[model samples]
Target: MADDAARYLLGIDVGNTVIKAVLFDLEGRQVGSHAIDGQSTRPEPGHVERDLEELWRNASEAFRRCVADAGIEPGQIVAAGCAGHGNGLYLLDGDDRPLVGIQSLDTRAAALAEELAAEHGAALHAATLQEPWPSQTPVLLSWMRRHRPEVLEQAGTLVMCKDYITFKLTGRKVSDISDMSGAGLLRMPECGYDDELLALYGLQGLGHLLPDLIDPTDVAGTVTAEAAAATGLAEGMPVVGGLFDVIASALGSGVVEAGATSIIAGTWSVNQYVSSEPVIDRDLLMVSAFGPDRFMIMDNSATSASHLEWYVREFVERGGHHDDPFGFCHRRLAEVEPRLDDPYFHPFLYGSRLGAEHRAGFNGVAGWHGEGHLIRAVFEGVVFEHRRHVERLRAAGAVIDHATLSGGGARSEVWAQMLADCLGVPISVADGEETGALGAALSAGVGVGVFAGYEEAVSGMTRIRREFEPDPDMWAHYDHRYSTSRDLAEALQGFWSSQYRDARRENNGEEEAK
Candidate 1:
């Protein structure tokens, strides 16, 4: 390769709300960045989708803008990689035409998930190391088989968001191990498809729909001429297979070592820990394949900053005097006293696994309390939710010494300090703003032999921006508050379970009627 070609690597991150692309030099310093805003299509109450053509177009535009900003010729780029949201299903016909984009958040497959769990009990769990969930591939596929059989019957290939984009660029129908593991098909220890799961789900012949699994740093293929023309990149540029967004974020935040934990506070907050082996707790959840070895244990809270954003928009609409609502809220929170009398709020705007039936509200509010009290209550409630996840991880035998926090939410000093106090662990912010893109670039560097290993690459690139240490007095107060929150969450678990069952039954009855 020419010297100019060896100087730059392109990284693309496909998120639910937007697609981000970054241009990095050989030294891993970000040279240029671009983003394209996109929204998920919600045709019905529970369905979500994106136009595959538009997704590709937006990604291509992002690449063009970033490359232009860098002032580099397209042919100067060396290797490229892509990362994306996991567990979303995208179907393609034999000619690579998109059938549909299955939204990951849609819970139409809940009944199918339960059915798979019932039919394949311990064996299935041992194989996949994951209980059947509505978001899993098997359950989603089962839902399609029953609801939209025509789409499944005609689908010649099944892939996730990143796989589809990679195939569009490289003309290879393949998936990386990280993406495959999230699909509820790959056997955990074996690191391949679980035939028992396939048979149990009546998908024995659906193997063709899956992709060839490759290592996270493997060279999947080179970009084709067609892709090159469309994206304004040189032909034959190497494309590395990158991991899912969670793993990429972990890598970018420098949490590669065992026992190192991170909280990626995006629209949803995912707490992750790298483990030498899979740590299973019936209560805590997992999104594995994040570590280099067997498993990277993870659990997620559906609402985090998104909930905060909602509250800010609803409550602080007219009070826009100084800065952004979030900034204003932070300023207000710092002035208020830490302890409140009787205004405890549950930050469950979209409902939570803890209590789906309960509507979010403040337990006590009076004329004395104003917007500041309400905002602080919401912020504290979110931090308490993080505490719940931390307790769950500890119970599952993962010793989390400290946590590296990243994402848009981590930028707030007040939120970071609140998290530290609530979890009683030191919290630090990641070095860069685009950690996900940086992580994908690091994976590509490893694939192309730019670095010796994952460790060396991260050590040379990742940095910490700010650190928050827990306050003893605040920690003591949060400890009691967290205990109360857990008790409340547990008290509603049975009610939520029943509500879930009833909703599933109602949906199934509607389907049967049709």
Candidate 2:
């Protein structure tokens, strides 16, 4: 039968905490999906890492399970692509063995980041269109060079997360322009590796460690027999150059055209828009390659629905709604409506753009507010943070009349509507639950000639499931809340800085005692 002869595309998404394997047909309908959650170990405060061996094992298991669940022959899956979190350091030793994997959540290079920013911020920005940040690939590499010189001495290749996955699958060391550029390792506009850029970060002689770069839709290599044996895929299947998860989410949400913004409210508040012309501003967080010549101008921070996640993990998980904590959260949020005097919450559990020392808290928690009100405040705080990024985008001359919404926040109708109402823009949620995987599969389709290019692939495969219109009546209310949030954040900067110093002192003291 024709259906039995049909081919499928596989997409793998690697995040800080989850690894997902999703299968999609030529028409972009999901056939089967599986995800595995892996834990990150904190050997030291401010350092977040995952074991390389464990990551590969979990990824392979996810692949096997996904193929089995689809109930299809592995040979029918013609090609695959990967999308992963950007800006972390994944290294291979001189012998090409897994050396270390530092996740993007790490902030071990904070002091170094600040030093680079203060000393050569302008020159660095001119070269890479990004300044030093604690979790940036270059900054983390520089940290390794300074403190852990042995690691750098043994390093043979520096790859992003998806690149590592590609290497495991195809036995090739290669990366895509999107992940490289997003990590600030490539020269902007040109979108190629440059020794001068590395030198700017005091990483002058490490150029050989960088992987070969290719277009996201180009086939990099074929699946190796080793990988096929470890996973349940056919040997010699095509593997496309992969994508940064942010760009994957954008593409999956049908935000390929210039000026269309994509806001992802997951672990990070990722707000970006594709642009034909590159925009460079010191105030902007980053500017990375999107497609062949396009750029994705972005403003992001580790502030988003992760706040609710933390709250649920620490507080709600012990309660009766343990099985479906998020669903319970959504119901609670729906029960509360906005009021002028509602408590203000800051969704900065990890950090913030204001500064790295920033912390999250619920301000003005009056005696009368219940759990529902607090939950609603958490939702509002997350949206307000997104609005902060969107404002920066607009200030940088990116149009934001409307945008696509994806990630955990977009899954909730109430949360999506809140985003629309808070940002005063029409927000559209895409059809699929795993847009990141769909985007990767779309790239795979292009790689294998199942589709001509991204535009055609998106046109054929992606569709909007719901659209949200901003309520003008609620705009004034949200505007007031946003302004207050900004004011409170500014006021708490001094306190956060003090808390950071105390924490450092305590950690140092304990280390000396040991």
Candidate 3:
């Protein structure tokens, strides 16, 4: 009976902060998980990178540990899928060795993207249906050609994070439509690359760099002997083309149909929903979902649970292990109730959705404040951002009937209630924190015939673990605070831009002196 229950699906997520592997049964129960701490190095102030070999080594080790920890044999992993951070360039050599691995959080190409936006801005948006963010493949490749032409000259292919890992596993280079179609590279609504469109972004002659694109649930390939020996996966175990981390999380949360919404408050605050008709507008960003005629509309920012993580790691946590940092932080936040006079934190320690020019810090503070007050403010600020995203979705005519919350922020009861209150809607959360991996695992299931399709797989596997209903009394208080936070951002944007100009001038002076 134990062996009967042991037939499992393995899902791997190569996220920004962690490389995690999770094992789940067909019933959608997580059996075991193992994670390796992932860190991206900042070579320059804006550049975020990882050593490719080091990333592979850590990811493979975590895969091995996950299987071992689950006490399952390698043969039990019938099928597997990968969910990874989207839109970063992972350059591969002709020999299949990694040349460069850039993270989605990278901003090294920001200036180049800005420079070309004038001539190609409309072209980019029309082709990809996405604003060319700094880490889009073309923008990053453009920066490389200018600063390091040799890197582009020797290149064979460009792939995202999960696609690279799939290559390492199966000796095949392929990507799902979900990653490719939205990166300002593929001509969207029509699903191929165009040389004329490539020329618009200075990528005219390098169209061959695009990988073979496939459906997210198609069999990408089977694991190789070399990969099996390293990670304890079966040599012939099938691997499926996977999805963007956000989409995987959406599927894992059972947001498979229209009117179902998902909010992932991980390193980014992602609020999105699947739509039969794509919503193209300024306030929202979109990507192809898993299938044809489907799109995922998202309003996201770097301002989310990472701020909570920063507060705990930098301030509350001691040098060694602390058992419950989140619990401790929640208790501290509980001390300070949500009041009219509380300080407002921008929570933009990372880049902001409000335009990159706006900086993040405490706008209002006083002598009466304490760490608890700051914690409360951070929680409120992150939820306020969630409210902003849902508002954008609503503005685009989304109903948002079922809003599911996932990620680090959902772990906090206090924060979940705050989000519910701020959004004025009842939100549901599922049992597993590894929803991204679980979503991948479900894709694996469909690939190997364990389920019929997403509709069947999601219904069979997912169940709502908890639900938070809005508190009527707190809505007015939060409404006032959220508006104040927005006002503060408007007031501070020009000052932050001026500060940036001053710093850039000082750096230019230093360089010219040399």
Candidate 4:
């Protein structure tokens, strides 16, 4: 037998809703995978946070289950990688112990986002190439400074979710470049934290919170004996710096070339294209894509499956015989489409590109419609939001001839076909659902010299399953609906603003009475 490649890789991805540990062979095929379903604690509306220790416990437990289920020994894993959701803030005390972890799905910093924009939006865009959002690390830190200065006074460092886990595993407090880039803290041209950008964001006073950045492919550290015992992994195994889930999904889906784009619809609508040069033309997020020359040009937000998940969980009672809730909702949704006068839903429950005043709602609902119509509206609404980003990318001269679809929203044939038709592009579904984990493993392969470099690793590991061609007839129909959706958003701009203003006034009155 020719030298049989027997080594395996372990990829750990800590997302907003789940902690996934997947094992992949050198060929990039998944040998086995396991997931732990956990949720962030919502103390109040829009304030999404997690208990730091609980998050780590879920990740470590998932590792044990993954190893046991995969029937792979800890020593068999040659190298490992850790992938996490980008942005948000995970702080460590002076003792390097985790404080509280705020996930990227949070909107607690909305007021701060407005404050930053009104004061320093242009400067921030010039530096980071994206506008401020509520979940970014800097905005979160600013909110803490204003509301709870005591925590900031006692804090030692701030890191992303995976950075904290990496620190726990290797006793090093380092973060991957992609995570830092998206945190609205780094200067794109310099690829490091900038004093000017910090000053503009009014965050220079707290620049000590930023963690050191390392390349995604760099070996962050060796798995220490303490971490190894906790997670059933071999001690001293190499742990590489992995990309953010957005970059990881692109890497995992094989969108490594400039023209190749990827749509990730997990908790967020990440519409990104791989580019050789970092362009700062308009308001788009750019992050390092594992290489110095390469960056992921992303128009993204918590505006994809998160919207659908929220709608079904709150309004629909879908359960019992179905495999999952979305499945049931989609099954009913597939029955209603291509018809005009359908309700238009704004996927702004989390936040909106239409400005801070925008909120989520369904328009054109009537007495004749049932639960099925609302379900279908939710699907189209989220897809419409994704199309909005795709349009922005297209306008920027980004070639999105064809794109790979990966995540929970892509699995639905109805929604997938709708996405293809609506975007007017051939959408291909990638082979693996755990693209983020696979991305991590491939980077580990690069770190350990299993592959010569990132390019070789990506080629050896990525595969496409099926492609859905856009239907000209369906595209014509969706074109009208898309225009209507845009018009609806524009029309409601005044109403959304007035609603927000009135609500704030009511709350102020209540506070005065107290």
Candidate 5:
């Protein structure tokens, strides 16, 4: 008889700061997991990057630790899959050496994004179902081509975060339709490479940089001897094409069917739903879904729990609260007394959907407030931003009666409840914390025929751990707060524009004058 370990699969989730390797049984039960934090460096203002070598090291260590924790032979693992944050540029030089590793939090291309949107907004939207955004892969590539032409001169294949991990594991330069389409590198609806899109980005003749496009479940390659030695995995283990992290999270949250929404409150605010047809009435972020002939209508931005993370790292950790800083935040939030006069915050530390010039701040702060009020405002601000994305989806005809919540925010009962109350809909949290990893593992299972397809895999593996219903009492309060926040954001747009322009002029004097 086959041993229990024989049915195990491995999944890797690569986020901006954390790399997780998790093992799951055929039934989707998480058998073992390990997470390692990676450092992001800000070499210049608005530039967020990582070391590719460091990322691979962290991933390999995570895999080794996870397999050991699971107490299973690496040979028993059937296949592996990776899911990573989407829309950042990962490049290998002409000689196949790590070049630049820009993360999705980058805003260096904000000015360029604005320029492109103004000049070719309609064309871009028509082709890719997306508008030029600061951290978009194509936009960033264009920036590199213009400002740092030497980088592209030596560039080799372009890949996403998960694809980088996949390449490292299997020695294959490949990406899936979900990530390439999500990165605005492909024409929408049909989901294929379009030279026109690259030309529009001024990246003409660089088509060779794009990796081979494959289905998410396609077996891209297998673990080589080098990778197996580094990661402690079996030498012939299969590696699937992998997935965009948000799509993986959706699958992990049991949102394979149309009309089901998945809200990932991670470093980015990702609100999306699967649709049989793509929505083109309005300019919205969308990508080809994992399932055939489906589209994931999205309204995502860099505004999300990242703001809270910054606050915690800067203020809370600096004050000597080391153990469970988030727990400390939850306790403080519990102390806050909801009042109409409470201060509100703008969760735009990264970029905002409203405009590229938008920045984050706390509004209406008074001497009378305390830490709890600030923390509560931070929580509310994050949820309010997610609400903005969900509203955009709703405007694009997404029927969101309910949603599955995942990511770091879902772990916090306070934030999850706030989200449910603010959105005025039922929010369900999945059983596992590492939903992205679980989603990648599902693809692995599908690749190896352990499950026929995503629907069957989701049905067999995922379960809602808890559900939050909208509290009718809090509805009016959140509505009022959201309105006030929206108006405040609109009121400050001029100020943001002027301030950002001035800052830019100071940083790049001759360029701004030109």
Candidate 6:
């Protein structure tokens, strides 16, 4: 007879800050969870890389700890699944050894992104339904072709971060559809590699570098003896190819249904919506791979908790030491009245790639204004930025009646409520903090036939903890502020673009002289 816990599954999520591993039973209850801090190396400006060997070692430790905490033997686990950050590029040599794994935050490929978009023209847009971004694979590949040609020449395969780890574990070089779809190389909606697109980028025959496209619920491969020995997993345990981290978070938040939207509030806040087809708007929004047969259409702002952290570190440094900074910020924000008498703020402290250029400062910081007002301005600024994303989605014909909020920032009731008010929509906090891991597990469950379909797996595993409905009075105030924010953002876009171009030219001239 099979023991109840023997049918357990393991889920691993590789995030920017941490690699979290969770053990779940067949019924979807978390038996145990463990986390390991992930280290990132930035050798130069606009570059971020992770040591592959170090990542594997840390993941192994986390896996062993989670398994031990669950009180389950290695052989007892029936299956495993993995998820990780998306968009970055990973180069593997002929023998499938990782040479480099660049992170999405790295902006070294910006010029290449623009070059490819210009060269490919309509073909690129028709394929991906979105223009190449600095983080896209094609741009990264082009960067490599010019800067690191040797690596590209000797490369046998190219994989994303998650796919590389999956290959290391299962010895299978396959990419799940969701992750592949985000690669700029794959044709969106069709979900396959485009040869002409690759050729246009001077990457002809590079299609061979990509793995077979499998559905997120597909059984990618089984653990081998080497993987079992390294990670303490049972040999032959099935491994499911999970979706990209963003898509997994969406699934784990139970926002898989069409018309549903989710705000992933981590280091960056990504506003995602499920649509029956692709929603591609170059001016304001973008689209990404959501699931095996689904699409995600929305806007992604590269700032969220990172902005909050910056405020706490720079302005409220001492306040963070005495008590929880988030809690303190929340309480302080609550004390400040909603109407600050036409005081405006721009939340682009880091100078957004798509938004306003001003730093976090009040238009009117009079002696009468106190610390509470300053803190409230910060919170209101972030929320207002999110509201702009919501408005962009609405303009793209998306119906975002509600959104599930998931991330470190979502823990604050005050912030969540502020978002609810700013967006004029209900916001639900996700039930689990580890939605990425849960989504990976749910995908595995579907792959292994433990669940009948994606809907069933999601229904059994994901849940919403609480919902925050929009306050009509506060929404009215935010609606007016949002209009002002948009006007300010648009007015400053050209100025930012000119500055960026001038800086790039100066830097290029210096490099040539060197």
Best by TM-score: 5
Q: Which stretches of candidate 6 lie over 4 Å from their true place?
A: 1-6, 280-285, 290-292, 313-323, 341-374, 509-514
Question: In each prediction, how many residue pairs overlap at the backbone (N, C-alpha, C within less than 3 A)?
Answer: 0, 0, 0, 0, 0, 0
Model 3, position 435: C-alpha lDDT score: 89
Q: Against the hidden true structure, what lDDT does model 2 obtain?
A: 0.89
Q: Give per-residue CA lDDT, model 3, range 1-514, as digits (tens).
A: 5754768999999887688899998899888789998778986656788877877888789889898888888899899999998877889977778888888777667657777776787777777776666777788888787777888888898988999889989999999888777566777777677998888788878888888989899999999999988888889999999988889988998888876899998888999888886677755665565687778888787789989888888877868466888888777887876679898988877557665555668757889998888888888888988898889889978887558998878778888888888888898987888889999999899888889998899998888889999999999999999999998888988898886677556645753574
Model 1, residue 412: distance off in Å is 1.6
Tens-place lDDT digits, model 2, residues 207-268: 99999989998898998999999998899999999899999989988889878899998888
Instruction: Write down the lDDT of every candidate, Cα atoms only.
Output: 0.77, 0.89, 0.83, 0.82, 0.89, 0.76
Off by over 4 Å in 1: 1-6, 290-294, 312-323, 347-362, 490-513
The TM-scores, one per candidate, come to 0.91, 0.97, 0.95, 0.95, 0.97, 0.90
Report the alpha-carbon TM-score of model 3 versus the true structure. Answer: 0.95
Residue clash pairs of candidate 1 = none
lDDT of 4 by residue, 1-514 (tens): 1332568888888888788999998888788788988867887566788888887788889888888988877888989898899988888988888776888877767777888888888888888877777788888888787666788788999888888778877878888878888777778756788788888766667777777789988989998999988988889998888878888888888878776899998788889888887767655644454567878888887778878778767766445444577767867776765478878788887767656567889999988777788887878888888999888888888877888998877777777888999999899988888999999888888988888987898899999988999998888778898899999999998898898777556645753574
Report the poorest 10 consecutive residues by lDDT, candidate 2.
505-514
Q: Distance (Å) between predicted and true CA of 199, model 4?
A: 1.7
Clashing pairs in 6: none
Candidate 6, 1-514: lDDT as tens digits: 2665477777889876588889887666889889998788887545778887777788888888999899888887777788887777888889877788887766666667767767775677776776777776777887887777877888888877777667867999888877777666677777777787788767777778888778888899998899888888888989988778888888887878878898987765678788777876765435677554478886775557667776787777664464676667777766777673546666665345462233344565677677788777666777777776777778888788889998777777888898988887899998878888888888888888888987898887877899999999887788787777667767766776786677567656754674
